[model samples]
Target: MGTAPATAFDTEALRRGIEGRDAAALLSLYTDDAEIRVVDRNTQPSHPKIVHGRDQVGEMLNDIYSRDMTHHLDRCVVQGDHVAFTESCEYKDGVRVLASSMVSLRGGKIARQILIQAWDE
Candidate 1:
């Protein structure tokens, strides 16, 4: 019997990146042409904030991780070329944020992601 092949996505690295607030590490998981669509109170489903390319995504990640907040990778599940994860964050002022993401992988790197987030108002 043949053994199952290992998946290319690194969940441990993802955990470290998210929990550690390491934007660069997280950015490394994406392909050069990767894209991210974000939906939140400001950017509703009808008009999501779209970030294209690794550079743009990096900028967003940097902005997010730079905030005075704590982040936790709550859950992650991977299947074939797809991954889904939940993240929770708390700001210094006690505002809590929750985010869920679904990602599509291509050749071991993230090709596209859809992120939905909500926070205490």
Candidate 2:
């Protein structure tokens, strides 16, 4: 089998994606049925959940991005088709996290992405 694409996903692209609110670039990393779950640190009892196709992911993220005051990508590690990273962001509604995620890629796009976070817990 041929080797995978040398998709060197760095902090810049991620930063741009978050700061500039580029959901298209962000969602392009995922597959058609990709899922993203963000456990909100600000909420109690339950976290703000997001799901569905790539379009929903974009819409959810775009909503947050539009109202976000600050977004910072703290750390990232990319290994072949997998990526693990921490992102810190705060919205006007007082939502935030130093969130970490593990993303598995298939055919050069995200097959599955899972996120977990621990802050003020």
Candidate 3:
């Protein structure tokens, strides 16, 4: 098969996908059964928003795309099949979010991901 995303550009692809609101490119990095857990100001540390499979992920991404927001990737690190990054997103409603995410990759696709955020409430 192929290798690990052709030297880390895949992470950048994810960054661009989010900033550009391109759900297809963003979801392309995930495996079919990939799961994402998000814990933020709305979501509690005790109970995170969990998404299973590509369909759910796509739906969630679409919801995010529907929002009038701007996304920026601040920093990223890829090491030993794990990737981590920090992102900031600002919405037209004056909500600003800073998220830190960690992901596990399998066969060049995201197998699991967790995102924790701090935002204006």
Candidate topping TM-score: 1
Candidate 3, pairs of clashing residues: none
What lDDT does model 1 reach?
A: 0.95
Off by more than 4 A, model 2:
1-11, 41-50, 91-96, 117-121
Count backbone clashes in candidate 2. 0
lDDT of 3 by residue, 1-121 (tens): 8754533438779888878988888888898999999998778879999999999999988887668899888998988789999989999998998989899988768889998989887
lDDT of 2 by residue, 18-89 (tens): 667777767766678888765655442266465777888778767756764677778788788788888787
Better of 1 and 3 by lDDT: 1
Residue 19 in model 3: lDDT: 84
Off by over 4 Å in 3: 1-9
The worst-scoring run of ten residues by lDDT in candidate 3 lies at 3-12
- The sequence of per-residue lDDT tens digits that candidate 1 reaches over residues 2-100 is 966645899999999999999999999999999999999999999999999978999999999999999999999999899999999999999999999
Candidate 1: Cα lDDT at 12: 91
Query: In lDDT terms, which candidate is top?
Result: 1
